[model samples]
Target: MDTRRILRRTRTGACLLAAVALLTSGCSFGSTTRPVGSAAAAAEEVPALTPLPRSTPAALEPYYEQKPAWRDCGAPGFQCATLKAPLDYAEPSAGDVRLAVARKKATGPGKRLGSLLVNPGGPGGSAIGYLQAYAGVGYPAGVRARYDMVAVDPRGVARSEPVECLDGPAMDAYTRTDVTPDDAGEIDTLVAAYKKFAEGCGADAPKLLRHVSTVEAARDMDIVRAALGDWKLHYVGASYGTFLGATYAGLFPHRAGRLVLDGAVDPSLPARRLNLEQTAGFDTAFTAFAKDCVRQSDCPLGGRGTTPAQVGERLKAFFAGLDTRPVPTGDADGRNLTESLATMGVIAALYDESAWQQLREALTAAMREKDGAGLLVLADGYYERGAGADFSNLMFANAAVNCLDLPPAFDSPDEVRRALPDFRKASPVFGEGLAWASLNCAYWPVRATGEAQRIEAKGAAPIVVVGTTRDPATPYRWAEALAGQLSSARLLTYEGDGHTAYGRGSDCIDSAINAYLLDGTPPTDGKRCS
Candidate 1:
């Protein structure tokens, strides 16, 4: 079992796919000391939410009615604006959350369609960043000609009063936390790390932390829609963005015009079930990587005759070797490549097949040459820790939203201990740590505001849900589940590797999506792309 990509959905920002590598497996390290008592509590499950109406709440009317004042920002063609949304939806007057918005007008040859909002799916990911960086410039020219490409930095994300937990050095320490604790002392260290992380977030963004839930973010999107003067939402959301898009559709079905939820998440799953399934998905990806790795002459995992199991064993052995003695990397910061960092680097490579060659090369250097710099670089990329030691708000906001979305996956170390075998059953390479990683939210200062529920979004227009058969992060089955859960969803299958399918060299996927977005023609149900 490999739980390398446990919280893959939340590791998004900039080009979601580029950040994909940095979304490396989530874990923090420990000092190998025991605590007086276990830092665990009973899991709290929120009652499932019924769909909210499209009608804006009276208190929120001001937010939805306000027009944005757009100005030239970033690139010459791009414009940026600030929009306001209620910090707390239920009690709208409590406060306000400001969102950053960006758009590029249609370069039209013909008719203009409505505004098209795009989110790349880090609950932490910056949607406005995505629009300015890629979708605004790279989407099909015809689609761009018709639609004003738009995005909003949902509350608590970058340039939107972004959440901050740990500073760079502290985050470096946090990422090194021992996820796979071998003893009570290790467990205590892990608990301390989680406490430190949760406390940092609480101290840094007390008010905004509780206000950044996905439900609120979706509502913020609606406000952005109205501010942009779009009658309905024309949107494309990838990875966790799919969850936000689905939440929008589920909440405001009539306003859900045309949407593409790529690399979908199953809203029906419990946090634990979701984590376990994701662990298995990573294992599936590692198995694929291993099978592919052995076929290459320079693969460090195994030779051509080796089986995937053998390769995994060899890799596991390598990891065990590093657990005690971290390999030295040429990092000026003196950051040696620990087992956690190296494993994260490997997980980063699993997101894209194109990176497999690089992984092989990195592994060769780490295993044969005793040089850990390449893997350390990959690990840094995954964490979004820049060469200058500056950190993005990505992971901070990722933890904030995910912790609020569902109850902690594991309430206690005992609970994790009980679920350990099953997690390992899901992924031998990365299982135990992920099972422990799920305990992260247990120490969250804010109680969870949401829970598992089926989102049929009944009465919504046809929504296209794209699934890649071998997507490592958002698994293929999640897309299937999401499509089935949405009343008018049309499933488009890409039987391939990597994360999301569209715009990643799959013409079939791109064409189908383009047709839906442009002509309102959904691809055939269960349409398959190679």
Candidate 2:
């Protein structure tokens, strides 16, 4: 989904630090000449360009007696390890950063397809946690049987050399900052909050604050691929991970193997465009939820006469109410449903369909029972908050990476104000606020190191780009754009909703992806799945 929103609630540096404590945490060109004929040929086709050299495989030393620090991880048949790589690839001799890695061996009678890496959207989402908790044990057996499922926490993320910021009290204060400011005093408070958060990050992790861009992480992936003894990389990445994977292909095209980029990000777009598109996406998802909610008896928004527009109005009213007077959730810390938390709760429900019912129930409880515990749980889960008020490093790293990848969309309050109307037009439900919130990076302590650029990995093998028709985070057109940009790419469309396609529910999507991972066969171009 929207990387910014996901990062804000779940991995936003300050919010993440507050939550748990605490508890925490390509191508060779083949030349084919079309025959010049009167009716068939509109124009003479040019000869296919020659493909570039493949990335030379690095030598990997096999471990004879590898003993991982295994624990009673919640998932069965999984093991964890700490993998080390240089903090800066440009300086390989520099001190290394420890990455949390997890794996589950292939359960196969058939020949193995080596290691298959998986990342679930958020630049801040814990890859190890996702692997141990879901993909490692929960992925479809057909795919799991042929590859050793693997994941590595990116630099500055959970279990890695995590970036830290605010402590419990500080985080609570930061999350309560008004995101949609209508007055100068409120705007000042928001800007101060961002500045303080950025200052906290710089003070806590200066070195990391400068090095967490998607490009550096992509380089880290290459190092991991070498360490794993894989000749080429096989991976499935969603949301921001799609940007990471695409960056990898661009950097080391020849090293690419079977790749599935679901919920694709358009590498060609700048941060502002991405943010604007995402605001629209969330609005679309809310509209869908609103339509479905009206048909149900338990909808929080009034029923019958209430249209999606009315539901939007009601939610906005709730947000406004929370802004003026927060709702208590009975937490020991006296935490209440502030505007930030409430918005996050809505964003969290956009990830999966199963969570829609949860959203309905939670909204009902908040409106009718005056109890927000259900919504709080969903928000906590999204943030990966722990028992204590401590948090993992996901959000810190997510910001570090995102802020570095592109320039801030807005540099000042005036800029945000000027852009508010367009953002609001994009998505009345979340647009204006998110557009303003996009200014979080403007006050960052570190200077951005990269900019949005097209990735045309010349020698990479065929890559599959999957998009959900009405995805709330990564817009569907991004997938189409990425596929068209890649020299050897094919587009796979999921005519459905929610973020990402494979393994969420559609057998058609899963089977197609499984086939690609098993053999070296990319799905047919323009393939569609429901």
Candidate 3:
């Protein structure tokens, strides 16, 4: 529901962990109007960064000088280690949080280029998992031959001191809880679910919850950078990871080096506006899917010549039917394909066009055959639901980090009610449900510690910002905005679909990014690749 779900998967062929992304929560800001400049043009007025001193603070020098005790883990070539950082950075003597890090040494015949740290977004995504599963072995051979691929699971993420919330059954029930309420009673039910989830997280990790903010995570990255023996940071961050990378650059501009932010998030927008725009972005992606679906003979929504609007109406009607008579998914847990789960299924596939065919088949089965298993599978995959009734710490950490990063998108149901019209205008099909979903953070136990602000990272070396034309999770304008905001950023446009561009099928996008990582050369500003 924090809809920052970006780069949940590896490549097109691999199963992606659904990145729950960021959704902030807590106290309200009354009478505060949505920030203007929702457009890219307005975001171009870059802010000047006030960076931290080049010299490490005396109290934090130890953390920056700690050595990683790497041992073989995961795949054959990969190694894992734990890096320690203070629980409360401002009070280093208070306590410490150990972070999990992984890396694969460069397999080179050429001179090694230090390390290349990578993160696959999800304030909650497992960076170590991503490194072993994808980046460690899937990167360009030349790049892989030259740089040690690295990753760190930020505090409160997997392998790190993770934030624990609901158990498997509890999470299943929470996911099934109706997001689109038709009556007051249902709305209260949804509200109660959110409260219960937040409470569970608070009850589970009271202290860690308060310390998992993005700012803290960025600080953790810097410690890792220093421990790796690198003089500067070379990184690749996608989706919410982009925000992390930018924050790093802003905080340590002098140490920033060859950063690639693909599928960027705009750090300038408030939660409400981000939710609204993301709702619109889903519409944009669905429209593309609908247009393609109508051409396929197996399409369940509609046939050729049918407008995307009509396709949406049909899908909406189907959802309405499921609101009452939920279809059977034959899930081992006996969960049915409720409207909420069904919607997540559709949303998951939209992240990658390669999944569109699977979505169509799932929709056809759910709509025509009255079988909900396929859609259920998609939803399960999105949530990273294991066959054994287990779940990763992803959702819990997602909420923990998100709630600490910004103010709640909506403080109350009444606020959501008031904003429904604008949300619906953004996407007729996803508007109602997503608007309700955005309310999850209102009950967050931790009050937000950060706010929307531009990151200029001035004095940093060239940072490449890449955006897909129709990126459903983080929009292209966000890349444009981020590029415009960062003093040394180069905007590389991928005229394609899906979430992030690099390491996908585009030789152009891949080559450009590969070159940047290998040679410290960035693509020209505003360079376009199909």
Best by TM-score: 3
TM-score of 2: 0.87
For the record, the alpha-carbon RMSD of candidate 1 to the native fold, in angstroms, is 7.8
Per-model lDDT: 0.78, 0.72, 0.82
Query: Predictions ranked by lDDT, top down?
Result: 3, 1, 2
Cα misplacement distance, residue 428 of candidate 3 (Å): 0.3
265-304: candidate 2 lDDT, tens digit per residue = 7776656666776777778778878888888898989787
What TM-score does candidate 3 reach?
Answer: 0.93
**TM-score-better candidate, 1 vs 3:** 3
User: Could you tell which candidate, 1 or 2, scores higher by TM-score?
Assistant: 1
Task: Please give the range of 10 consecutive residues that has the lowest summed lDDT in model 1.
Answer: 26-35
Best by lDDT: 3
Q: After superposition, how far is residue 371 of candidate 1 from its true place, in Å?
A: 1.1
Global local distance difference test of model 1: 0.78
Question: Which residue pairs come into collision in candidate 3?
Answer: 8-16, 8-17, 9-16
